[model samples]
Target chain A: MEKSLVINPDKCTGCLQCEMACSYENEGVFNPAKSRIKVFTFHQEGRFVPYTCTQCSEAWCQQACPVDAISLNLVTGAKEVNESSCVGCKVCTISCPFGTINYNQSSGKVIKCDLCGGDPKCASACPTQAITYVDADQTGLDKMRQWATQTDNATSNTASNA
Target chain B: MHYIIIGAGPSGVIASENIRKLDQNAQITLIKGHKEPPYSRMAIPYFLEEKITEDGTHIRHKSNSFNEQGITLVNELVSEVKTKDNTLVLSDGSELVYDKLLVSTGAIATSPPIEGINSNHVYNCWTLEDARNIAKKAIPGSSLVLMGAGFIGCIILESLLKRGVNLTVVEMGDRMVPRMMDESAGGLLKSWCESKGVRILTSEQVISISEAKAKPLQVNLKNSDPLSADLVICATGVKSNTGFLESSDIKLDQGILVNEFLQTNIENVYASGDVAQGLDFSDQSWSIQAIQPTAVEHGRIAAINMVENNSCVHHGSINMNILDTMGLISTSFGQWMGVEGGEESVLLDEQNFRYLNLQFKGEHLVGISSLGHTQHIGVVRGLIRGKVKLGVWKERLMNDPTRLMEAYIANI
Candidate 1:
């Protein structure tokens, strides 16, 4: 079965290990600026949200790519940027609704998450288990299970009170 | 069913692909006028900058992509569209019949009418051939005078600089990118480019270009001294390619007119990309948005309507322009000029080359223009495109325009 990277923002500690791992895996650096996965800090609310390419089946970046540089990797189901073909026009960056794809000024090419060719470094590097790779068909399975267990406990508590 | 798509630009290619997806047995023919592989003209700047090779500009990297997809690639120009006959007369004296026809011939660069503008050493950076010619003549330390400071001009500004040319930009407007930027924002862009060693002459016009003994070409100005340069690159503007449809029944305006379904007056004829003037989302007006996103949207919608019989209606496209001049990033979205009687909130930091102007109509955010700030700015586009009601956040934004992210999350 195909696997997908699932993110649980509630479990995130905002240590940026995922960012470092992603940058090193893709760009060979520990710089968050170069990382494809970004953690946005909501300073006022004390919240951190990690965001990256969701690998949309109908990706705007893929469709709007002037040179057709973005293509789907069948094995990983990841939209990969062929750097050799990319002209670095930044059209993909602008076309992406989530702003996940960005221009690499140094290489003169656009960069995005490639799921590390099926073994995502961000998922592997998460210290808090906030990011995990699971079956693509069951991305919401864990959340559903958690809610189901809570409902069962509440129903049992009500029965005992009655 | 046979689908004939003229022009192998983004619109035609995407439409063909989408059609192939929807109809497995449909025969798709993509006619490209140029001899080169289907390539993007927008990638010409990158080609000129030596970031990628000429092959890198091909719309599809694989040589046999169209063939593999069962799409026939025709290398001939359409001379006329016979709407009555449901046929296209190509330049090579050949006629092709089609059940449905899509006109996506795109736009051509237009040079201002001036004497000797076509003289040697003057070129338009429009096509791959133009980029090749520019790359040869734009050697390091070469003197190049670029005319016009519009969107196209500013796009190639950095590429020209990176080539190490002693460059001078002459714009007829009072400041840079006047069509997309306001006076204050445009003025700020001018100063930023000037600081990067570009000689900018605003409110200046090139009267004529003549051959000179001292230089390759002499560019005469309307108000100032003539400038001598090794090359003169014109980036004035572009006009839609609708000459082929002059005699046809296809409606015409500044471009070929299409309705909400991207269909012309003719039932089987459709138009998309820069060639089709359709609906504008911000003001519900009809206009041409010569951008890639709009082209992609139009292609998909038109192709869907072609196969599914008016199954899709184009809601219209937002007017968005993003530019990176030198190292500064600037963007304008929707009705950035602001409607009359609309409220505006502006934040200008000339010292840091940062500026933000938000235009609000009553409780809704309608438009925005920003420079030098890139973090979470996509929310600004989301707000404008979503037409979110700002309510009390309008006053909060007026107090501090930097709170756009907060305003967007709260409202959207």
Candidate 2:
């Protein structure tokens, strides 16, 4: 029962609705800063990339979180942050490579993505299927086809040249 | 399959009704993460100034009307999304499985990285809760320190100044809303703000903030200086809520990237609202502006594409601005600032405060910005969005704005 969000940067228009959904789901308000999932805009490249806690089987934010504020939810396979236990020290914020976990200064708590338990708000709010909650194991299917298209281009280019 | 939509904001509620209209047999359940019904985010500054009440800012007509249409309104949060089994785990431990899913999760305020930003007086006005808290503490003649003098900052200053809030707006940038207006307009706006007693600090970066008990928040400046204020607010910007999304297979970048169809890589998942950055008509790019109109439009477009795919959806291809502050009403659509094609013609009467600036690329109207005039505003928007030629309106645009549209429609 592994659940994960599949993000396609090509389709992403970078609206921040996913971030809004994540924050509203966990924080009881429509706040993007409080959202566990983060969307980063690559302005120079004319692209938008939304990233969140990948909820890796080997979670760094979870292990780095002091007082065990972050824990893996078995039902949805999401690493959730317990605000009451979170000290807002931002230890996990530093320890995680992606920097998904953040400290809420107002609430004096640490927040990260919890997969909305399992029905992620980001995936729901996305007007484009840029972000989707899908089978973790089969996430690479799109990439496989994408590369496969690239692979076919070689023969087509060679044929056109001939 | 019963549909449960969460966070009855503009995105969630509109999505519900659109879904119902498309597939009437589908049972819908809408959940609100907050106590109040969905409201417009853009009208907030006006509401705070007593120009309009909370109802005046509502994006939804009759929120409770959803229940009459056989939609369940759940006043709670959806604790989890169990993607493996395809079910929603609510705060009450309730679960809902849907045939399709739409996430209208909006954005949050990103508090700037300043010193002592957690003081009791520091605030960010992105939520009803934040607004209420700031309002409770906002008193006449209360000194205010606002970080990031962007569009929101200027509007907030204009609105709050009328009510006697001693305000000082600090921006890291050299000009205000550099993305929207050109350098000249910014200089004019800077003078306007200063004339209104709104202290403007440009090219000044707030390093950190010290304690604010008896004195104002001691803001350590980029230079070896410090400013003090009783209340400090960070309007720097915001980041998206893609946290729990890590576990899911949703593709994300500045936001969840959906295609023209507004469908995620996954089978039945869709994203919209502030968090979803679609297309930018202004720069022919992809960026998300945390404006309330874009959120509602994104939700509507996404919901339509979700159920039916008859029409194409564009994350706007141009950058646009339409705002009215005090007696000033101005709008600029498309790239009017420094694009090479347009020849600039401005009618500026400082004494009368009747300013109309038009930049023309050949005979068509490329961009327009004005003060004390309300004609050709919608016509410009329609032209920019439609890329229609302004053969008829060009001769009489500077003369009159209201009739400009009629003439253009007839000629074209």
Candidate 3:
């Protein structure tokens, strides 16, 4: 089964380990600005949300690429940007509704999450288990189990009352 | 079903691939007016900048991507579309029939009527061939004069400057990017480019181009002294490539008229890309948004309707333009030009080269134009596109327009 990166924002602790790992793995640096995955800090809400490319099957960034520089990595299910082919017109950055894909000024190419070619560093670097590599078909399994356990306790409490 | 898609542009190529994905047995044929393999015109500037080769501009990295998808590629100019018979006449006197058709011929750059404008030294930088010729002439230390300072002109400005050419830009408008930017923003851009060593002539018209003995060409201006240059590039404007459909029954206004499904008046016929003027999101009016994102969306939506007949409806596209002039980045979204009675909040730091203008329609953010500010900027688009109601945040934003990301996070 194809694996995917599943993110649980509730488990996040505002630590930027994922961003550093992503940048170090992909760009050979520890700069958060150069990282493909970004952790947005909601100061007022005191919540940190880690966001990156969702790797949509019908990706807007892939379609918006004028030179077909963005292509699917069948093994990783990641939309990889071919640096040699990309003309860096910045159209993909605009087409992406989530705004995960961004242009790199140094290389004149757009950068996005490629799941580290199937060995994602961000998920492994996430200390809080907020980001995980799970089965593509079962990304919501953990959430479903949590809900099921809650409902089971509620049902047992009613039965005891009866 | 036999699907014929005219024009091998981004719209046509994407639609063909999508049609094949939806219906495996459908026969998809993509026709092209140019001899080159399916390539993107937007990448031509990079080609002129020597950043990418000709092969890098191909829409599909694999040359046989079309063939692999079982789509036929034809190089022929479409003469006419016979809607009644579901047939098309090619320029080579060949007639082809299709069960469904999509016209996405895109647009062609227009040149102003000036003497010697069609000369060998002058080019329009619109096609790969034009890029090839420009690459040869726009050499280091060469003198080049570029006409027009609109969106297209500004886009190629960096490329031309990168070639180490002594560049001069002439614009008829008082400021650069007149259509996209307000006077303040445009004027700031003009100063920015001027500071970067580009001789920009505003409120000037190119009277004519004449061959001179001292230089390869002499560019005469209506109000200023004539300038000599080795080459001249006209980035004036572009018009839809709808000439072939003049005799056909396909309706044409500013472009081919299509409904919400991107289908033409004739059943089973559709249009997309620069050739289609469908719907606008901001005003809910029909207009041609000749941008790449819209073209890609149109292609996918049009293909879906073609395969699954009226299964999808286009929600219209926003008018957006992002331009990188020299190192400065500027973006405009939705109705950048404020509507009547709409309030506007502007923050201009001319000395720092940072500018932001937000146009608000009541409590909703309708439009935005910004320069040098790029953090979480996508939220600006989301706020305008989602039509988020700002309520009290409107006053907060008016007082501090830089708090857009905060307003977007709270409201959207």
lDDT of 3 by residue, B122-237 (tens): 99978899889888989999999999999888989999999999999999999999877888889999999999999999999999999999899999999999999999999999
Q: What is the C-alpha RMSD of each candidate to the true structure, in Å?
A: 7.5, 21.2, 7.1
Residue A73 alpha-carbon offset, candidate 1, angstroms: 1.9
Q: Rank by DockQ, highest first.
A: 3, 1, 2
Model 2 ranges with Cα > 4 A deviation = A1-162, B61-63, B77-84, B89-94, B282-284, B309-312, B315-318, B338-344, B349-366, B392-407, B410-412
Cα lDDT tens digits, model 2, A1-162, are 576889887898988998888777877889876776666564446867676666654354554332334676888877787664454434454333244565565664566677777888899999999999888777854432232222211111111100
Candidate 3 residue-wise lDDT, A8-77, digit = tens: 8889998899999999999999999999887877775898878777775546678788998888887777
lDDT of 1 by residue, B158-237 (tens): 88999999999999989999878999899999999999999999999999999988888989999999999999999989
Best by lDDT: 3
Instruction: Please report the candidate that would top DockQ against the real structure.
Output: 3
Comparison by lDDT, 1 against 2, better one:
1
lDDT score, candidate 3, position B171? 97
Q: lDDT, candidate 3, residue A158?
A: 14
Candidate 1 wrongly placed segments (more than 4 Å): A140-162, B375-377, B389-400, B403-412
Which 10-residue span in candidate 2 chain A carries the lowest summed lDDT?
A153-162
* 2 or 3, greater by DockQ: 3
Q: Candidate 2: which docking quality band?
A: incorrect
TM-score per candidate, chains pooled: 0.91, 0.65, 0.92
